[model samples]
Target: MPHPNPDAMAFLLSRRSRPAKTLRAPAPDRAALEPILTAAARSPDHGKLEPWRFIVLERGALHRLAGLVEERGPDLGQDADQIAKAASAYRDSPLAVVVVEIQKSSEKIPQIEMTYSAGAVCLALLNAALASGWGANWLSGWASHDRAFVEQGLGLSADERVAGIIHIGTETSAPPERPRPDLDTITEWVTE
Candidate 1:
């Protein structure tokens, strides 16, 4: 026998991501966030290879990362607007959890499967944050793709890449509901 949790199901159906810019303090403290992290860790991994990691960026770290974005912009050939956009993520976020994909060298699990596992972790973290009563958004910008930025800013390994930056904080305003895909148009039922 299985017990059904309708509230959880409903929450998943209605949950929306709050814009990172609109997220304000006070964000979840370590004690409050631990369970959410644990929930996020429950994401599927084909070979039980935890090929993902998280880096929690607190207030000071955000400022430092912002400065790194500004400093690295010229070298990366990023225009002023692009630099500002990259820097703004740190400037605006009250708290951010950087999910990193640590690609494992294994014959059994394909590289793409490892990437997929990392992607699953990102979504899990986002959903966990939302379920924990905090607004959350998963983001990645040009900064995420720049090797220098990843290495210097977050000290990521050569095989590691930024999967997402999960920003969590209080919602300043509710985001308007957007149109969802029509299920019938996307789903198919097959019977033989």
Candidate 2:
């Protein structure tokens, strides 16, 4: 027999990502966010490599990142619209957590697994924030992927990469539920 947590299941099923632009101030403070970060840290990490780290960006940092996006966007071949969108995301965000994936040299654990673990941490952070009554959205764009921007904006070393940038704050409006993938269409049953 297996025990089922209906409340958790229901929450999971109904979980929705809040738009970063629609999120406002009054974001979670350090105390409020500590537990959320803790929850996110509990995500699965194969071989216990712990290859991910979090950088909590305050409003000032967000604004700085927005400027960096503007500076580096044109060089990266991002058009004006793309630059504006990405810059506005940082400029408008109340707070954010940059999930930095640090690749570690391991004899047994492969690098891809570490990358997957970092990705898991990003989702976990987003979900934890949402579950804790905060609007959260995970974003990655040209700025996040650009080497120069990342190194300058985040001080990421060569071994580090941005897994995701998770914006968290108060919700300004309730977005309509978008259509979800049909599980039957995406899932395949396997048996041996």
Winner by TM-score: 2
Q: Estimate each model's TM-score.
A: 0.96, 0.97
- Looking at model 2, the pairs that clash are none
After superposition, candidate 2 runs with Cα above 4 Å error? none
Candidate 1 matches the true fold with a TM-score of 0.96
Residue 31 miss distance in model 2 (angstroms): 0.2
TM-score of 2: 0.97
Q: What is candidate 1's lDDT per residue for 5-42, written digit by digit as tens?
A: 99999998999999999999999999988999999899
Best by lDDT: 2
**Model 2, span 1-192: residue lDDT tens:** 999999889989999999898999999999999999999999999999999999999999999999999999889888999999999999999999999999999999999999999999999999999999999999998789889998999999999999999999999998999999999999999996
Candidate 2 all-Cα RMSD = 0.9
Task: Give the C-alpha lDDT of model 1.
Answer: 0.94
